[model samples]
Target chain A: MTDKPRFKSARESGYLLCIDCEKLHPLSLEGELCDRCGARLHSRVPNSMNLSWASLIAAVILFLPANMLPIMTFKSFGQGEPSTILGGILHLLDQDMLLIGLVVLFASIVVPVLKIIAMTILLCTVQFRLQTNLRQKTLMFRIIEWIGRWSMLDIFVIGILVALVQLGNIAHIEGNDGATAFAVVVLLTMFSAIIFDTRLIWDNGVTDLPSDNSDEKDTP
Target chain B: MHGTPEQLIACHECDLLMTRVANKPNEDVICPRCHARIFYTSINSIERLLALSVAGLILFIPANIFPILSLQVFGQSQSEIILQSALSLFDGGLVLVALLILLFAIVVPLFQQVILFYISFTLHYRREGRLLRQAMHAYQHLRGWGMLEIFMLGVLISIIKLKDIADLHIGLGLYSLAALIVVTTLSSVFFNPHQIWHQIDLRRQKRATDDR
Candidate 1:
C-alpha cells in the first residue's frame, strides 16, 4: 500500500481517487488522462493547432470573394440593385446615414482584412520562431480574436432583411454568392482565434511554459 | 512503478491533481501542485473582449457621423441612412431591417464599450471593488450584443445591387468605416486574456498573505 501525500481524502460514497495524483472529485469522467495537461490518463484530440491552421488558410482564400463581391441584392419597382462593400457605404452616405455608413465600412471591410494580415503575421512568427516584438505580436493576436464575430454583422443583417422584407413585387432583399464566402471568413477567424494558443507568444524557441520572471531575464 | 490496467495517473495541470485508475483516452485531470485549469480552458476571455470594446468605442464616433454610401440614378442621386437606415427601412415599411441596424450597429457597441471600460479600470486601479462574479456576469451579457461585421456586410450588398441600377459614389464615411474595422480587429488580436488572470491571481495571493 502506498502512503500518498496527505491531502483531504474523501470518504464519501461514489468518490473514486486518481491513483497517481491521489486527488478525488467525481467519477465516470470522459477520458483516461487529465484534461488540463497532457497526462496519459485518457486519450483526446491531438494536432489541434494543425487542424486549426488548415481551416484558417481555407478561410483566408475565401475572404477575397467576401470582400470583393456583392453581398446583397435589392429589388425595388422591378429594378435590380447590387452593391459591393464599397458601394453600400457610398449609398449610405448618399442617403445621409453618414454614421451608419462609416460604421459598416469600417467593421466589415477594414477589420476583416487587417485581421487576416495580423493573424498571418502572428502565425508566421510562431511557426518560424522569428525574433520580433513578442509583446506587440501577442497584442495583435488578442485583437483579432475578439473582433472576429462582429464581422458577421453584415450576414446577420442580410439574414434579417431576407427574412423580414418579403413583400412580393413591392420591395425584396436577397442573399448573394458572396454571403457564403463572407460567412466562411467570419467563421474561420473565430475558430482560428479560439484554437490558437496565445501562450506560444512567450515561448522563446522552447516548448516549456516561460517562467513568470522570464520577462526580466529576457530583456537584460 | 507498478503497472495495472486500473492504475491511476495524475495530471499536472488540475487543481485537484487526481490519478487515473484506468488508462482512458483524452481524460484530463488537474494537478495537486497548482490550481491550473484543465480540460481545454480558454486562457483569457474578458481581457480579449475588453480590447475589442475599447476599439469599438474609438471607432464609434466615425461610424455614426460618416456617410456610408451615395446613389446617382436617372440623373437624380441620393444616399442610404447609416444608424437611421433602420428608420428609413421602417419608413419604407422594412421595420425589421431598421430595428436590426439600430440594435447591432449602434446600441450594442455603445453598451459594451461603456461597461467594459468601467470593469477593466475598476479592476486595474485596485478599487474597493465590486464582486468579480457580478462584473463578469455583466460582461458576458454585454459581449453578445455588439454586431459590427454583420451590419457591414449588409452595407456591402446594398451597394452592389444599387450600383447596377444607379451610379454609386464612394465618400469620406466609407473610408472611415474601413479604418474602424482595422482598429477593432487589431484591438481584439492584441489583447491578452491571461494577463488579466495573472493580475487577479496576484491580487488574491496578496490578500491571502496579508491575512496571514
Candidate 2:
C-alpha cells in the first residue's frame, strides 16, 4: 500500500470547506455564507462544547426519574401495579425470559448510563485539551454516536405495550409520567452527541494554535 | 480533467485538510492523521444502491400490511398491525408519542428508502432534472430519523414483556420488518455520500461545458 500524504487542517491552511456543497473557500470568508450552497461557514462549529455540556447536563438530571419512577402501570381485573425500568427487567427475569430481560437491561439501563459517562469523559478530555488517547477517544465518540439511537428501544417497547394491551379494564396498560422523562433523556443525550464536534478532539493534538497554547497550559 | 489544482477536502473526524486526488476504482482515500475514511471510488455503487433500495421497498409493504404480533388472552385473540399500534396509542390519548413512533418507525424509513431509490435510479440512467438537488437534501436531512432497527428491537422486547400476560405469536409482518431493516442498512452502507456528490458535480460540469 502506498503511504498516504500528510495533511494540514483547514484552520492551519487558512481555508474552510463547505460541508453541504463540498466547495472550498478561504478562511477570510469564515463569517460569510457559502457562495455555492448558502450555508454559513465556520472552520469549526461555534460553541460546540457549551451546547454539548448543556444538553448532557439536562440528560443527566432526567436520567433519575427515567429509572426511578414507574414507566407504566399494568392493570388486570381492577388491580394495578406500577413497574419501574429495573422492576420490569427483574420481572422478566423472574419469568425466566433471560434473553429478553438482558437485552432490555442493556439497551435501556446500561447503554444510556455508559453513553452519558463516556460522553462526559470525552467532553472533559477535549475541553481540558488533554493530548492522551486521541485515537481511542475519537473511536469512542463514533461508537457512542452510532449506538445512541438504540436507547430509544425502551420508549418504543412502552409505546407498543400501551397500545397493544388495552382490553377495556380487563388488562389495560397506561403509560406513566416516567415514560416521558425517559424519552426526554434519550433525546437530550442524542442532541448532546450531535452538537459535539468530534473534529475538535484532534485539533489540539497535531495543529499548533499559537494563541490557544497559553489557554491550554492554564488548564493543566 | 487531469490536474486542475486538486481541490482540498477536510477530514470530518480529525479536521485534516488534504488536496483531493483521483483514485482508481475500489480505492479509498483515508485520512493520514486519524485514519478515518475521507472518500472512496467504488465500482458500480449506483447499481448496488438501486438494487438494495428496491428490495427494501418491496419488503416494506409486507412490513406494514400484515399483523406484527397477536395476543391471546382468555379465548379472545387480537392481532396488531404496525399502524394499529400507533392508532391505538392515539386512542389512549398519547398523541405526541403516537406520532413519534409512527414517524420514526414507519414514515421516515419509507421516505428514506424511496428517496434512495429515486436518486440512484436517476443517476444510473443519467436523467437531468432539478429535483436531484432536493432529493439529495431530503436524503441527508431524513437519514438520521429512520429508526426501523430500533423499532424492531422494541417489538422484540414487547413480545417478551407480554409473554406471561398473553400467548404471543410473531406474525409475518415482524419478519418482513426485520428484512426491511437489513436491506435499508445495506443500502446505506453501499451509498457513499461523497461519491454521489462527485457524480452530481461531474454532471453539472458537463452541462456547463456543453453550454459554453
lDDT of 2 by residue, A37-99 (tens): 456888778899999999999999999998999888889999989999999999889989899
Best by DockQ: 2
Candidate 1: stretches off by over 4 Å? A1-32, A35-45, A205-220, B1-212
The models' CA-based lDDT, in order, is 0.55, 0.80
Binned by DockQ into CAPRI classes (incorrect, acceptable, medium, high), candidate 2 is: acceptable
Q: What DockQ does every candidate get?
A: 0.07, 0.40
Using TM-score as the measure, the top candidate is 2
RMSD of each: 14.0, 5.8
Worst 10 residues of 2 chain A by lDDT: A211-220
lDDT per residue for candidate 1 within A1-220, as digits (tens), equals 2542332212112233332223332444424553222233311123545766887798888888886888777787788887776777787779777876777777777878787788778778768877566656765776677676677667656654554344456656666667667767776777676656544443333222224423211110
- What is the DockQ score of candidate 2, to 2 decimals? 0.40
Among all windows of 10 consecutive residues in model 1 chain B, the one with the lowest summed lDDT is: B8-17
> Model 2 residue A70 lDDT?
89
- Cand. 1 Cα-lDDT: 0.55
